[model samples]
Target: MSDSNTPDPNTSGAPVPPRPPLPDSGATGHPAPSTPGQAESGTPQPGNGWFAHAPQTAQHPQAAQHPQTAGHHAAGASFSAQPTDTHASRTTDAKVGSGKIVAVLVAAAIVGAVSGLGGAAIGNDMFAANGTSVVSQGSTTVTVNDPDTVNQTTGIAAKTLPSVVTISATSSSGGGTGSGVVLSSDGYVVTNTHVVTLDGASSDVALRVTTSDGKVYDATVVGTDPIYDLAVIKLTDATGLTPITFADSSKLNVGDTTVAVGAPLGLSNTVTTGIVSALNRSIQIASSAVPDSGEQQQDQGQNGESPFQFDFGQGQQGGSSSSGTISIAVIQTDAAINPGNSGGALVDDKGDLIGINVAIATAGGGSSSSSEAGSIGVGFSIPANIVKRVTDEIIADGSATHGLLGAMVGNAADAQDSDIAGALISDVTSGGAAAQAGLKSGDVVTEFDGVPVRDATDLTAQVRALAAGAKASLVYVRDGKTLSADVTLGELTE
Candidate 1:
């Protein structure tokens, strides 16, 4: 695989995608000065605005083929330094009256450089004891002391980099590289299921993981949950590894600082910084499937349950009936998520994992064969709460079980248009959780597990967030009467 930093000749001709709109609340400072042929020092420069660096390749392995849909696979983009005009130069003259001016200029230069001004100004008084003409047209280099302040991006990267890893998977069909996060010291890693499996097949896939220290180890699949787009893999021989900490994603708020770490476009250990752009976004992408004589066939779990479903608006079904699609409630961020960033960590300011960087919204609309563009700042990640719940189930058993309400719920938009305040039950499965709980058709589910159910999508997201067999209380309105009942959630079946 090619390194992500390397430029690609193929993509050189492609048009640069438009950037997503950024919030106007942040400080609008001047850009930092450019230092050609120099390496980044990870210092937070004043006016060092963020931008999405296009990946070398547009071929994201998980990118969706359908452009008309909202959920499309996207890769992570690297964040690189851009030129700015924040740095300024000062000149000192060898005059009797210029001593105070020179001292003030030097002090200002030092302060500016330390505060992310990107450069420093020096006077000739320090170099020469006697009054000598030091001011010249030639350029002079100034050195400044490193600031004591800590950069949040650098700090988060330092704390979590060891726990992140690069995952390379090869199968008879094809091979690609992605990222993963360590879950246990003995080598249990969590990644997107698509990272380890082929497009259409699960078996016969070979997996390997490369840690931050440059050690490579063979790995095997422990379990996979395509419905949630997550998987667990174990290294053949791993020990004493640092595992990442999970944060409470439910408490996240918009504008909270976020850092995304992954191997974008095969460039390992890349980090990008941004804020939580939004929350509770529902996205649906095409499910992983193999082509059968030009027809797509959805992959089923061991229990024969289809792992994906489409959420067509107004409760109308869309897409191929035989094929399935995965719908998820995601955390949105402006962090540069590109191809190869799939299954990577989206951490908060404290270095705790809050989400898994998954798909990016591209200007090209993405295709099944290849990504048409890189990140546009609209990146989505699976919330850590869902990750924690689903991964726990996968680790406990070889498979994951989702909680099911066993009812056909009306679309939230439809309910709103019809003046309904909750999830309207269009039908209830016989002997299912709803039926057993005394819920009947035409009942509107007002609340689930103490959380308000604004619509069908809200209810679906809440149910998926729960574990199978968990006890929950449901409040619904039946025949214009409000009622409440305690129900034991049933495991979703094929």
Candidate 2:
């Protein structure tokens, strides 16, 4: 319900000694981070490797590390066998309803909705009817010719696996595993910013992507929307890639089937299944560390290295920081998301893209360490509709725009004697859209654009999901009377 949103595991909680940097193979796994200013444990960390599961020592690795780990891992024999898993999948049939209010890290739900991309959104033809796309103009994107009907869970998994990828990001700081979805032919991939940037640990990241076909390729970040926790990266000289089919998430209903595909715990080609637990669920969390210049640094990694942070060396970093808090809307599902599943795909029964996996709701709260972060049948994703809008803008313009209500608002529940759940307009910017529409302080917004407005979080998430200059209808309460009005939204500038 708050910022306790547990970002999917950076580590599977399996504590293995850090492996040495393999040539052309990304940064080797490093032992889990110890307490502040302490040596990392090379010995196995008992009973903490994964969330309610055993670590696949052969596949899972301690992802994301601090820079001070320069000398932590010894270079010698391999840490574990580097076997490739092409068609690996196991079912974890768990489900949770959207009404379940569980404590979770809120990173995934922070970004609610956004609708622009304007001229840039023109190429949605790339994702054609029934999840098929025409040949991309400048690159080769292989699609499943008349893919099999996905009536069952296995069918969904099989249809979508090839389009999901296991991303290994390493930096001089450390390295860890996450997930991504193929967006275009020219090797454009959509993933969580935390995955490539290791939860904003470092800006300098080198990425190594392993597709479901067990093919590995190097990639670079095309752009990132940290406020939304979404990022687009492009593969280098990539071809024959199977593009994912897009589903209209706004048309989805509760109880529809969902299948999540990713590399959870660093296990590649992993799949889990669930249903659409809820919609328009808004969340807020601390903002990611973005460069003041608002520009993404190009790949500065050396050949055969990852952009993830693994402190195999002793290089130390001081206290880290981010910008501030951000609000977002998300899709809630129970498809067993894990630490490494960030930026992966959460598809529907037709194997169509619906949402991109991000964070999970855990029961308890403590430190930021994901060593024990596991899904409690409550996970969050960026809805495909929003993902499409933000990614399209990022690919075309290197950033995305969000709608502004031009009003300062708060949760109505905070008002004494208030008996409703909605967003209370505390102040309206003069000459702003809301003010021009006659909205004033003390008005409680109950609905926006036909969607229910539960609170300020919900209102903000809803407004930000649309394009600036977009027009919308809203119902609000004033002086015990209900009123409706049409208002054009404004642009949110950072």
Candidate 3:
């Protein structure tokens, strides 16, 4: 089924109006240029006081010398409490109390005429509310409502969202939808691993991919790296595809415009734009437990668990804050990303893919509650460079492998506690490379392949950058002894 470009109320509706704008608030609520010149209403305008003098009429030259009337209001001005235009020149010659009475009558009559005119214009429809007539196309329309600005993005969206796909995976419990981008003409698609992971085995996992055109394809998982929240699936015999162009994420700077395209809040093919709020931000995927928040409660149904897990055989205890940890840099933006946006591409103004939209920060602890699951102007994405490296590894092999040292490194501040300024061997896998090479717990590997190691995160990144089966020399301090060991790197397995 082709996803319609029509906006969804939850994802693309007009924002709720704040309190009415008062002149004293110092904030202007002026509509954009396309709106009518000014808002019309039936009320007394400024400069109609008893002592206020009317401008000498150049249009009415003959009446310029005549004193203005107390019962009359300026032309085009209407008051709910005044009389009609017939009392145009009621002067102060009348008794003070009588002048006030006539003024009130004139004001009421003018207001009645204005109301009658307004009612006719609206066809006497009491439901002619301001927001009812307008429809929001996306975030741009919600904010500016300018045709040029709204149309500026629609063309690109029309061509792109069709190629975007929604993925669903089923296990013993159930399944959910996540967004994906087409990767090849041969029907290969890429998305987040958690979206298609099987609780037991791949054989038990029922994976389905649906294009925006409503065509559903049965997919076979090609490879996955849950550590990076990425997965690839092959759609049989698919052709005539449009692959997204990848941009250099490193070139992206703060404040650069970006568009987030995905099926957020179950609204397919939704598009939102915002600037790169920050770059190279560090976010921890401590746990998969989503909070009991508004929309999330519906998305997460029951078990307060993540749809996926990051248990890579460190034996660090699954679900621990440290188990699913990927200590790396990420890009942060204000672009709205909701439930299904995970794994979708974060593209630049030119429509080139830059990053993979990922985890959002939740607002609570395990037993806490939340109000919304949609983007709160704080969304994060993995850099494209990292995605390229991991994807390449998975495509070349059936799975991904990262070079590893036998030790886990900590920050510099934490390293001082043990006087080991290198990758610290927290625990060693029995018969693994480090154990076989005489590297032991409490020993810190300070250098790798001639490069100095700073902390655990830096070490993990450097090691992952290297291919498995490579020879690396490590410099470590053991019980105050500086020792060197040569060990062949091993692939990190889950």
For model 2, residues 2-91, the per-residue Cα lDDT tens digits are: 212222223465564554443442454544334321123221112111111000101112222311111111000001112123223221
Q: What is the TM-score ranking, best to worst?
A: 2, 1, 3
Could you tell me every candidate's TM-score relative to the true structure? Answer: 0.64, 0.65, 0.53
Task: Using lDDT, give the best candidate's number.
Answer: 2
Candidate lDDT (C-alpha), each = 0.55, 0.56, 0.46
User: Which stretches in model 3 have alpha-carbon errors above 4 Å?
Assistant: 1-152, 198-203, 286-329, 365-368, 415-462, 465-490
The positional error of residue 95 in candidate 3, measured at the CA in angstroms, is 74
lDDT of 3 by residue, 103-177 (tens): 211222222333312323212211112223222211111121222222323323433454466665555543445
lDDT of 1 by residue, 1-494 (tens): 00112122234457534434554444665444334322254333222212111111112223244221112122111111121123433323323232212222233223324332222212221222333222111111121122122233333455567667777766555556667877888888887765655433346668778886678999998887766667788899898776767778887766556778777766666778877777756555555432221101111101233212211001011122224545467777788776667777887655667887766664543332234444667878888878877777778887777777777776533544455577777777788888899998778887887666666665666676677888899898877788998887777654
Could you tell me which 10 consecutive residues in candidate 2 have the lowest summed lDDT? 71-80
Error of 3 at 14 (Å): 28
Q: Which of the two candidates, 1 or 2, achieves a greater TM-score against the reference?
A: 2
The better-scoring model by lDDT among 2 and 3 is 2
